[model samples]
Structures are given as structure tokens and as C-alpha cells.
Target: MQSCRNCPCTSRSRARTATARTQRSSRSCVTSTRAGSSYRWTILAAGVVAQASFSAILLGLPAIAPQIRHGYGLTLTQVGVVLAALNVGLFVTLLPWGIVADRIGERAVLATGLTGCAAALVVAGFTSSFGGLVAALAAAGALGGGTQSASGRAVMSWFGPEERGLALGIRQTAVPLGGAIAAGALPALSAHISLRAAFFGLAAGCVAAAAIGTALLRSETTKADEHEDASPPLRNPRVWLLCAAGTFYVTTQISLIGFLVLFLHDDRGVSTAASAGVLAGTQVLGGAARIVVGRWSDRIRARIVPLRQLALALAVAAGASALLVHASLWLLVPALAVAGTLGLSWNGLSFTAAAEAAGRRRSGAAIGLQQTFLSGGGIVAPIAFAAIVHATSWRLGFALAAASPLFGYALLSPLAERRS
Candidate 1:
């Protein structure tokens, strides 16, 4: 107390304390920044795995349509019904799951849904009857629906707006990635072993994906700016328009993914394995296209413009594929590949648009709503395409399905104009 204020030792002590505090603060900041930067990528990886696992089941079943038809002694239309069952289940649950993801977070929802989906697929593998099979597939679809919204929401939360487009695009690749795997593997599994074996393989994928998600997925804490002036997702007109456009887009996707194998095999007389191989190739190309388009949107800083352009390209590609449906394999193969790749590419764009319109706070619900519309189309496209084919011809069904992207293009025009 006696002139300690002027003491050199006291001043030195204060300086050392300040230096130590600054060092600790700097270290903490570096640690936090590194964690934030690195973990988003981990979340992305987990999201991709979760999405791909479920997609293998959703899209894979259609790749082996002939086997499914032969196994169940069903006609083309019945196969459509069987394929639609999964969509029906997804249509019912996607919105609710989205809401749940917003409330409870992505990790719990993805883990629970994927685990349930795996169980349902296991039940599907055991079933021998058509009714039982449809029921099981539907159940799997219902449980698997969470991945659609949860993974998308996770991407939106973890990444900044500038990076979200590309991040989501990478996430969307899981669809084709899963489809490629299923198209290549499920058909072989069904043909070499049995249809049950294929179902079991999909179940194994779901189990692995669920484990990865549960282990790696963590909910990001809600940020204050995320909720400020945010519109309710359901009430947003832009969200609805995006959903409607996505519904139309799904028609093309389902046509390519759900029926490409059948068209190649039955119409072009390509062998099933060869047809599935074409589909697998299409999926690989589509996945690459998604990444490119996503990055393109990020560079251009306009999601809707790129989305509209892709829609027009898809329309043209689908029409070309239809025209070449019965052409020589040399011509038809590349046409179908281009069409299928275009058909599968637009989803990530629409998904990003919807989430952005609703704001991050409501991104889950917006994604859910968008997926619900897509699921509805997925349910109808197969049955309608089959019925059209049954009534007329494969060429006619392809022609009609080609028109869907045109409609999507028209619906997206206003949004693109506004964005520009």
C-alpha cells in the first residue's frame, strides 16, 4: 500500500497478467474459428451419406423393375403402383419431418428416421407378397423422408449464404450417387442372388448411413439474424412457386430414373444389365452436373436464373431423348444419357432457392414443403407414365414427360426475372 502504485515490480506484474490474458484469448479465438470452419465440412459429409443411403432405397428399387415385375407377377402398371408406394409414404411424412427438424434439430431426426427406414427395408426383404412389399416400401419411404429436410437444413445452418449453394449442391449429389450405386448394384444383386438380397443391401446402406449421421451430425445453435424478419415458410409465395416448379421437375426425374431402365430394356431391346448400366452412368453424370451447376450459381450469385436455364435445357434434352427413344443404340444411348443427366441436375438449384426465400430460421420447413411436392410428383409420375405407355407407346410417354420441364421453366421465369 505504501507507494506500491509506483513500484516497478507491481507494474511488471500487471503487464505479465495482461500478456497472459491476451495469449489465452488469441488461442481461444483460433481454436473456435478452426472448429467452425472444419466442422461444416464434416456436417456436409454426414448429410451426403444420409441422403445417399435413403436415395439408394428410393431410386434403386426402380432400377430392377423387371425383376420386381417378374418376382411379383405384376404388369407394368402394378410396377408403377409399387414404385409409387415409396413416394406416397414420403409425401405423407416429409412436411411433418421438416417441422420436427426445425424444432428438435437435424441429428435426432436423421438418426431416428434412417434407423426406422432400415427396419422397414428389412421387413420389405422378408415379404413375398405384392401387398406386403408395397406396405414395407411405403413404410421405409415415410421414415426416410426426414433425410430430405434435415440434411438440407443442416447445410443451410452450417454454411454462409455465399457457400450454401455449392454446399447444398454437393449434398444433392447424394441422390444420384445413391442411385448410381443402386442402379449398378441392386440390379446385379437381384439378378444374381434374389430381389430380397437387393433389399438387404439397401438396408445395410441405411444402417451405415444412420450410424454415420448419429456419430457426426450435431445441431448448430440458432443465430439471432436467422430469425429476424423471417417469413413463415408455408406462407411464402416464392416457396410455393418453387415447390410447384419442383413438382413439375420431378416428373422428368421420375421418368428418367423410374422408367429409363424399362424403356431401354423393353423398348430398345437392351438387356436389363445393360440398361441398368446406362442408368448408373446417367446417375454418375448427373452427380457431376449438380456440383458444376451449384458452383455456377455461386459464381453468378443467382440461383433462379441458373435454375430456369437448366429447366429449359432439361426440356430440350428430354425432347431429344424422346425423339431418339427408338433410334439405334449408338444414337439413343447418348441422347438418353444427356436427358437423364439434365433431368437429375435441377433439384439442388430449386432446393437452394426455397431455403433462401424462407430464411435460415425456416429453411427446414421450406425444404420439407418442397420435398413434399416433389414426392407427390414422384408418386404420380410412375403411375401416369406407365398408364400412358400401356395405353399408347413408350415414345408417346417420353414425349409427354418431356413437356413437364417446360412447365417448370415457365413457372420459374418470374423468379428468375426478379433475381436478375
Candidate 2:
């Protein structure tokens, strides 16, 4: 198990290759496989494949929640527990997975985790009890949690800072793209056949993805790669700030993801399907926004003035959108879009900034630590929203969501300043 301390990774020159054209393009034609490297892009492909599969399993469960309920006669809370367990799995492993990614090279961890997730998904398909489902999803979560960050690190290593954001954004879209497939297509499969059958099919997808990922994600040294050098960590402050910013961003994000449908039903007087559709549409739009923001951030990476200003603007818009929920249900869609776009758009830039801020070699750890903050928000957000709703209403809940970005805006200013 070679640590980042011992392992030779992509060089520093790769980190700062931020030319004007390449700044926004994550994978430059001139920079394939780094000088002597072999199959770095293959690792990224593996990550995407694994991520897409995990996306299917993660959302597939919820898509067939009703069928699951009918078959087992379970409670909504029981179904919710399955979903919650996924996070619990992820939360518990966040730190260790990061450490592992840093230790063994991101590829080893990625391949191993994907394989483990496939096994979990296989076992989950056979379980009839709610407890079994929880265990299975939790297993999947723990093994699968690192996929997102590790993939980001892999891509960021290849691309210069200018293009890293857009590159990562394209990669990050897999989350929603996977979810949309599950939401839109898996439902029919689940309903048309059986819940157990759906799980079984998804488990098979995991196996195929695992094989793909293992083949793609690997260390360059094995293939005798050449690359430039970069700085090491002082435990970069910009990394921590990005983590903090992510905390606030996801706190708001998870709150809406978990409860927006409920809010639509109770407050806006929409049917469940309609509400779900609205939320789904918002996610799709937000997914696009992520790509846009990533590319936009890449274009302006050299200019600290615009980066800070744009981040601040996102916060302000999010805050204003949160308040607009009381105005009209139609208004809620755009508000959610603004909130989603702002919250998720940071997917590429924040991580790109971390990679740039700490040098490219340690991007895995930077992204990993930042993910800890993001996962921490997942823990706090739903509970907070539940408390807020219990005390008052989801309206107040969203208002709380709006306020978070203001603080994030403040923290990010210093990073943009430092970059300047």
C-alpha cells in the first residue's frame, strides 16, 4: 500500500497547465497519458462506469419503493431507512475511503470499492426484510462513497486548473444522469416486472461496471508514465474552505432533495407525482447548470475578481429564491432551479480550486476531506429540516436553507483573493 508520501503521481506541471484554450477543456489533445503514463483515462472511464451503475442501484430502490412496500408491507419510514442507510454507509467510510484512496492510489480503491458494491447489490436483491435492505444499501454506500471523489481526483490530475472544473462537471453529471435513468426508466421496469427482479438487474449492472472500472482506473507507474511536479499540502486552507462551502451547499441541497416533494404536496397543493416531476425537472436543469457553471468558472479561473463575484451572486440568488417559495408554486420550480444550479455548480470549481490550491498530487485527499464536509451536511440537513418543519413549516425550513450561502459566500472570497 503505497501512500501519497511514497507513490509518484502526476507531476506539478500537469497541475498548472492552464493555457487559455485548455483552461476550459478538461482533457487536452496535447496531454494524453501525461508523458510516460499508461491508461490514466481508462481509470476515469472505470469511475464513470462504476458511478453510473451505483447511480442505478441507489435510485432504483426508491423508484420501486411502493412495490417494496406492497411486497413486504413496510412503512414509509422503513423505506426511508433504506435510503438513510446509504448515507450512513457513506458517512462512516468517508474518512477511511479518503485515506485509502490516498494510500493505495485512487485506482486500487476505486476498483476494490466497485467490486464490493457489486457484491452488496447482489446480496441486496435477495433480501426480503427491511433490515436486510438496510444492510445491503449501507454496504453499497460505504463501498460506493469514494467513487465520486476518486473520479474527481483522477480527472483533475489530468486536466489543468482552467479546464478541471468543466471536466469534473461533465463527470459529476453522472449522478443526476444516473438518477434520472433510475427515476424515469427503472420505475417501469420495477412496476412491469417485480421489485426483486429490478434489484437483480441492477446488481448485474454493478458487476459489469465493476469490471470496466477495474480495467480503467490504475496507477501510471505500472505503465511507466512521465509527468511534471507540484507542491505538497500545508493542509491547504482553500481546501478546508471549499469543504466548508460544500457543507453549506449540500445542507441546502439534501434538505430540498429529501423534502421538496413533501413541501409541494402540503404547501403548494400539488399531487405527489406532479411534485416529484417538478423536483425531477429541477434536478435535470440543475445538472445542466453544473456543466455551464463549471465551464464558466474555468474561463474565469485566472480572474479572482469574477470567481468571487460569481460565487457571491449565486449565494444571493439562492437566498432570494428561497424567499420566493411563498409567492407561487410555478415560482417554486425556478427557485429550486436556482438553488440547485448554485449548489451543484460548485461541483467542478470547488474541487478544481482544491487541486490547484494544494498542488495536483494531493487532489485525492483534498477532494476526500472536502467530501467529509459534504457528507457531514447530509447528516445535519434532513434532521434540521425535520426539526424546522415540526416547529413551524417547510417554508421556514427553506428560509434556513437560503441563509447558508451567505456565509459560504464570505468564506470563498478569501480563496479567490489568495488565488489572485
User: Which candidate achieves the best lDDT against the true structure?
Assistant: 1
Query: Alpha carbon lDDT of residue 223, candidate 1?
Result: 38
How does each model score on lDDT?
Answer: 0.88, 0.64
Count of clashes in candidate 2: 13
Mind giving the per-residue lDDT tens digits that candidate 1 earns over 1-420? 868977999989999999999987766543432344689899999999999999998778878999999988999999999999999999999999999998899989999999999999999999999999999999999999999999999888777767777899999999999999999999889878999999999999989998999899887643344445567888888899999999998998898778989888887788999999998999999999999999999898899888888888888888898888768899989988998899989888889999989877788899999999999999999999999999998888888888998888888878884632
RMSD of each: 3.9, 9.7
Q: After superposition, how far is residue 168 of candidate 2 from its true place, in Å?
A: 1.4
Alpha-carbon TM-score of each model against the true structure: 0.91, 0.77
Worst 10 residues of 2 by lDDT: 220-229
Please state the error at residue 387 of candidate 1 in Å: 0.4
For residues 1-420, could you state the per-residue lDDT of candidate 2 as single tens digits? 545535445334444564644654534334554532345455556655766677666543554555565677765445455556677777778667766666677766776777788778778878988789879988988887777666766776665455666767677666655665665555566667766667777767767766676666654331112243334333566667777876776776666555655566656787655655655666576568767867877776542344455556566666666677778767767777667556555555565666666555666666667666776676566666667766786667777876776676677776565442
lDDT of 2 at 32: 53
